[model samples]
Target: MTVIDNTHQRLLPAPAADVGRLLDRIGRPGDPLWPSPTWQPMRLDRPLSVGATGGHGPVRYHVSDYRPGRLVEFTFDPRIGLTGTHTFEVIDHGDDACVLRHRLVATPSAHMRPLWPALIGPCHDTVLEHLLDNAEHAVTGTVTDPVRYPWQARLDVRLFSVQVNATSVPQNALLLEAALPPAAGPRSDLADAYAARVPPGVTTDPQAWADAIFGNPPPAVTALFRLRNALVTPFGIERGDRSAFDTISRTDRELLLGTDAGHLDFRASILVEPDDDGVTVTLSTHAVAHHRTGRLYLALVRLFHPPVVRAMLRRAAAAAVRPRPVTPPGLPTTTPLR
Candidate 1:
């Protein structure tokens, strides 16, 4: 087995003690500044101490060493491919600043070699950068450059499949299935309302409402829709741009949004069909993986697709039932659908 090491660091404009205090709270689930959007927050079975078991999402690990306001190390489970330690340490940089570092030193087994550079490495870099940005925000009250996924990293992990029950407010299907011309697309009022409530730096363009049915959307209106879809399907894909929604397909009952991300092609639809009581809205996605890495990367995604899709669908259903104001006629809007 060959050893592979990855390290990422950020300088905070604060003292070591202040930085360490923030580091101590890094893995706590639901922390406002913890970067849960980039990397799912870690849920630990016990408090931050040696021997506590916890990991974020699918990765499981146990704490091997711990020190308050200084360092913590998690030794990942062997089943996760590489066997090694992931450590977070805080060091004094000067009277005014401190450096926070995350280091992963692991030896991968033969079978895991292809996965490193292709999938894991890119995702790791993305999540780490966001985490650092989160730390800076904690100390400085602002993030200089909010984290955005690199194009390659976004392409490598994009996968979308979700279904949501819009039975409570069946009219949601109408809103969900609304179409825009391939060029100047019409905005979805419901989506715009939702997007306005999202935090800064996220997009709320109405076109995103369709593209989000199957892609990983940023922390914008698409994300809100994805959460709604999660009520039925728990999974989604993320990318940085609206280029994914460039092409449009529409029928009386369905609306499709399509785009190509490098070597991968993505097509997603919102289908509205009548049911026993109200309408049933189904959001589905299909992808054409173009190369060897694409196939292999998607294979990994398939393992978690079912749960991810279901979660997204369930959430979307719940959201549809919430009351919202309808956009009035003749009101000025963003754009018009041809």
Candidate 2:
């Protein structure tokens, strides 16, 4: 059995009430304190009053107490095992300054004991710091030293972060004539659309979404690119025509890219559609095999392409929202919680 008392606090250059006001919106639409997109937004079944039930990510808890503009406490569900409670409190510093704090006191269950230190603990500590960073920035407009998780913590966070599943591409996303279909035919030998919702914690603008989706090539992608070059060079085929993520066109709301390789012409469509909540970014792949080699390549890649595309989209969404100290030329590096 292991019991832990953990706490994180930040002094902000705003009145205590001002900082405390953020506590009231903890699980609300415009949460200013809980770092999100990078982390799950805290959600309650109801409002933030006592008895409101919910938790962020996989954590489950119910509000045991609430004090508007001062403090709030959440009691972890006993089913999950809890000792004390998790709380957010505000303390007065001066008329123009205050302190905001989050504390968790818990005794890990036998199942969680080992996992907590290795996985949960670091992520928890980092998330708390990120929350406090958000608090400081919300009240003070800047975060000089934002929380940065070590590689292990970052990996744990990604492995445990919100999961957005892939789905059939929305018709709206496919409507971008410039992004899909064969230039000469209604479709191609390999025309498929897979999509995933852009996370709420990321910007809804199509251009920003495009950058998130294609800017960083995941290691898997880069490795495959190298392997592809090696496989194609032996046959005197132009292997890097796609250059991994080639862009044919870009606009404020959509992007078109792909390649006309030696044996196949492949085009991909990444579409961003904004709605009330956030946006959905759809990735659609189209390929026309010009020869048996192209057909064979498609047949082999198809088995893994769906998962690969889904992973690429999921990775991009996570990258767009990783917490960092806010330094601005435009918006804060993080998208505002919606």
Candidate 3:
């Protein structure tokens, strides 16, 4: 019970329920293990296991209490020389806003505490910073750039382009083509919702299939989904989740939100499946509007249209699966979610 270390304050943009629901979705009972999350089964009423293997040796953890969304605590075996608790709490900020808090409580064995400064102190700040970013996205629908805790908040602005395509292997045939603007246009915010029935392996790659598509996408995608709704000014739209367009990069981009007086966010996700003959990949993309009036500005940008976006992505997918037969001037060929 000695407080060897603690991170007292972590704030998130979402309300309590949203954050809680998300935690349940990722670490709930029956959910498969995700690498090595700090929380363990002992913390929940459901069954759970704890252990990590990597550059470091194995570390085991014990869970103590589970209150789904409200709180989860963990105590390590004395052999591990560490005990800790993590709590997620929601508080009312105003009629329109809520605060989510994440806290860490830790005690290290005599041998580990003094070494904490050299061993774990540097990372504690980073872990808390990451938690704040994740929590904000979970509730607010935007992925804010990493910021320092309790001080010096900066703003982040960005633009994204996403494309999706479908093709059949062996036959090297193109199936369907689509994107946000509906046909060939770009900047179309329309959600490009499609269904495909294809053969397995014809679509998803081995390990990537389960990770990028089949599973629930990572938190960034969820944040994007939430932020997409709050854009009131420029009013924007999404074709698919941001995860579907992993090729897109955020570097060397114009800023979207500022620290002093701005919003923070970005997100993406995609899902793919194979059927009898081919695979179907669903892509969803979203953008955030900054100023209260920016929503209309963005929605008007819809001039780019969605159909055109889909066509381009489809062509790309076709090319990947099967080379398009080139008849001098004309030829065609063939893609997923987070």
lDDT of candidate 3 over 97-195, digit per residue (tens):
455555656677888777566645544444445455455544544433533322111100000011244322211111212211243224333223322
User: Model 2 — which ten-residue stretch has the worst lDDT?
Assistant: 329-338
Kindly state the number of residue pairs that clash in model 1.
30
What is the model-wide C-alpha lDDT for candidate 1?
0.56
The model with the greatest TM-score is 2
By the lDDT metric, which is better: model 2 or model 3?
2
lDDT of each residue in 193-224, candidate 2, tens digit only: 76555335677566565566666658887687
| lDDT to native, each model | 0.56, 0.72, 0.38
| Per-candidate alpha-carbon RMSD to the true structure | 18.1, 5.2, 22.1
- What TM-score would every model get versus the actual structure? 0.50, 0.80, 0.35
Rank the models by TM-score, top first: 2, 1, 3
Give candidate 2 misplaced runs (Cα > 4 Å).
Answer: 162-166, 176-187, 193-199, 212-215, 226-239, 242-254, 259-263, 273-280, 291-293, 303-311, 327-338
